[model samples]
Target: MLTELHIRHFAIVKSLDIEFRNGMTAITGETGAGKSIALDALSLCLGSRADASLVRPGCDKAEITACFAVAKDSPAARWLAEQDLDAEDECVLRRIINKDGRSKAWINGSPVPLAQQKSLAPLLVNIHGQHEHQLLTRDEHQLHLLDQFARHNHLLEATKAHYRQWADTEKQYRQQQQAKADREAQRQLLEYQVGELDEFALAEGEFEQLEADHKRLSNHRSLDEASLFALNALYEGEHNNANGLVQSAGQRLQESVDMDPQLGSINELLKQAMVHIEEAALELRHYQDQMHIDSAELETIEQRMTQALKLAKKHQCSAAELYPLHQQLKSELQTLIATDEASEQLAEQRQTLRQAYREQAKKLFDSRQRAANQLSDKITSAMQQLNMPHGRFEISVDHDNQAPATAKGTDQVQFLVSANPGQPLQPISKVASGGELSRISLAIQVMSATQQTVPTMMFDEVDVGVSGPTAAVVGSMLRELGGQCQIICVTHLPQVAAKAHQQLQVAKHTDGKETQTDVRALNNDERVVELARLLGGDKVTDLTKANAKELLAS
Candidate 1:
């Protein structure tokens, strides 16, 4: 419930402060007399777009503040808490617009974004006007409003979860199908590469061994000639042969060894050298015989080494890495082979999720239909006293099973109306006049408010195009609804304005060169004059005041 509103330098309202109360409190003023300014101020706090042009000509900025008495668990309070804003049992919202077209909004003294303001607005007040009736025409908004009125929040949450599940499942199914399609192209590439690698059949360390063999074979003739020459010089050469020379020296050293013991040790050393020289010559002969060069084998080994190096460079890796690369390709091939294996499983899972989505959607549709019938009947009963004797209102539920399911549901619901006798009921947007729409909107609001948990309801211009008994009925209905929650109605009807438990009059006054609008809570005597002014005009005649008093007395 809005407890108070303060406006400064906003439009024609230089400054205004008004305290509001529970039950219907009407605001009455002449046309262009700043009644809409009060509503505009409220709209600013409720997140409506701000225009710098609304500022008083000489003012630098326009500001509006609205205070609401909120419940601890009220949606508005909850929203404020979620946004990390200050919220207590009472909430104060302030909006300021500067002359440069910049605007700032605050909740409970904490600055907040405009989006947060909009998200929190509905929790503070619900305004039903000529435009708000669009809620009845739009399918999703209608469902949401109806569910709110029915207090089926938990059910709506469940439906939303199911909708999300359906969407997620479809997304996964599409991805899996695309993966299957992509696998075929990948398989062709993997198969060709794997075939090439398998055919090579290269051995580990084989490249190193081949390189060694190629070097040895390339110098085989030179190695053979050097070994043969060394062998002849060591064992078979004339006087310079190492074996013959060392033996001859050992014989001389032994003959001399008898002359001295040191000569005998030197002879032993000479004999050892002769033995080692003979062993070396024998090994050289063996190598000379084994050094047979085969050009064909050398060519084959050289070609193998060249091919390995070329493949390594082409793949930008060493020859040793080719084996691991082969294994990777084989693994990918297996994955491609198994792509169709899981296809059936995906289809089955999709069917199951589809069935679950349908079941949840069906349950939501059934609950809405049941609740819509009750709501339609309740609102029709309330519309009777507003002067449409044979007035009929209905909720037409159209199932869109063939249409794709949306987040709300697979059903479309609209409010239908017939304003006069024998007139076929049509969509509320199509058949209702401004007066009829006002009353219908009020009736629906009354019904919806009764079922809501909100602590306040604010009505702006709800009494437009209504007067006399119709306005009285509207006022009485608002009062009745106010018994359930805080109700505030902005009106110009003297009949309705007179019915307020509290009366606030919006008066514009020009003091010297300054123009200002201020809202005042009228005392009983003042209310008489205000209502008389509403009934008559700028001039409140004595007869008008008498009639106003009489109306109050009744």
Candidate 2:
């Protein structure tokens, strides 16, 4: 339920704060007293369009804040939790509209997009505008009303999901059918590329090793000559070679070792140098033995390298990248093959989805048919209480089995009405007068309200064309609705105002320079005066006061 509304510099409201309770509230004032200003401000908090004109003259901005006490398991609470904006059982919606026409919204102190506010508004409050009866003429609106009255949210959601699945599968099937020739061409190209790469069979790291081997083979003669010369200089020379020179030096140092201790250290260094020289000589001899040039191996290595380069150039890659490219082409070929398989299965998939969608749509149609009957009966009964005793209301639920599937199913809902006895039922839009439309709209709203989960319902002059004892009856119906949830009505009828558990009077105040509208809760005595004003005119006579009291008493 809406607990409070705060408005500042909104239109002519200037600044006003109004507290609400868990019952019917009647808001009334003189014609130009701005009784609807509060409702307008509340609408802004509910994510209605905003404009610079909504700001009071000379004010920088307009602000509206609405506070509600939500039930733990209510739709509003669940939505807030889903958005991470829940503040226990309390929800606050705030909107600020600057004079430049830009606006911002917030929920639970966290800034939110205006769309979120719009999405959450219906779960918290249902506002029936003064002109709501105009919407009843549309077929879509009639269908929506019936579905809302049906209260089959899960069924509706399931039908929508099924429809989406069917539509998506059908689109995929059509696209695949159109692209069959193209896919087949692509598959052939991929297969050829993959086959060539597989035949090459390049291994990881093998390219670098092959290049090294090719270089060695190509320079075989130069390498063999260099190794032979090094071997002769180091060991094979026999005279003054490194090995003989170091051995003679060590023998001379050994002969002087007894004469001086320093000679012993020198002799040991000479011995180590001779050992290293011998090891070097042996390694050089072994390298010379291993050096040989084979023309046949060289030709074979050159041929393989040329083939690798040629293939790399053809594929627009280096030899090193040939392996990776081959793997990539194989993957693409596999994907195309899988797509072919999936396309072959699409017909069966689409058939299954189509059947599923039809099943859900049928279920939705059945539920709506049952709900239409119940709603028609209840609204017809309500019309009698609203002073239309001979009126008959019926909801026509026509299911078209041949129609293409839709998210809302294939049922065409139409409201039919007869205003007098022995008259045939006709489309309500074409038959009902303006006053009858107002009463019928009210009846429908009342019946729909009973099925809604929203805790607050506001009616802005929904009783516009109603008067006489019928107005009193309208008031009584609203009061009865208040027993289930909060009801706030912006009205001009004294009977409606008198029926409310609480009343608020909107008054306009003006100085020479400025004008502002103020809304205040009325005391019992104050309510009587306001009702008297509504009953009579600006001049409240004693008889009007008496009549107001009588209305209150009743």
The Cα local distance difference test for each model comes to 0.80, 0.90
What does candidate 1 score in Cα RMSD to the true structure? 5.6
Per-residue accuracy of model 2 over 1-554 as CA lDDT, tens digit each: 99999999998888999999989999999999998888889889999999999999999999999999999999898899999999998999999999999999999999999999999999988999999989999999999999999999999999999999999999999999899999999999989888887787778777788899888878878888887777676667868877677778888878888888788888888888877777887887887778777888878777777877888999999988887888898999999999989987998999999989888889999999999999999999999999999989999998877788888898889999988899999998986489998999999998888888789999999999999999999999999999999999999999999999999999999997999999899998898899999988898989999999999998
Best lDDT among the predictions, by candidate number? 2
Write down the RMSD of all candidates, one decimal each: 5.6, 4.9
Global Cα lDDT for candidate 2: 0.90
TM-score of 2: 0.76
lDDT assessment of candidate 1:
0.80
Clash number for each model: 0, 0
Off by over 4 Å in 1: 134-141, 175-182, 199-324, 331-349, 432-434, 539-543
Across 236-305, the per-residue lDDT of candidate 1 in tens digits comes to 7876788888888888888887788788878888888888888998898788777787889988988887
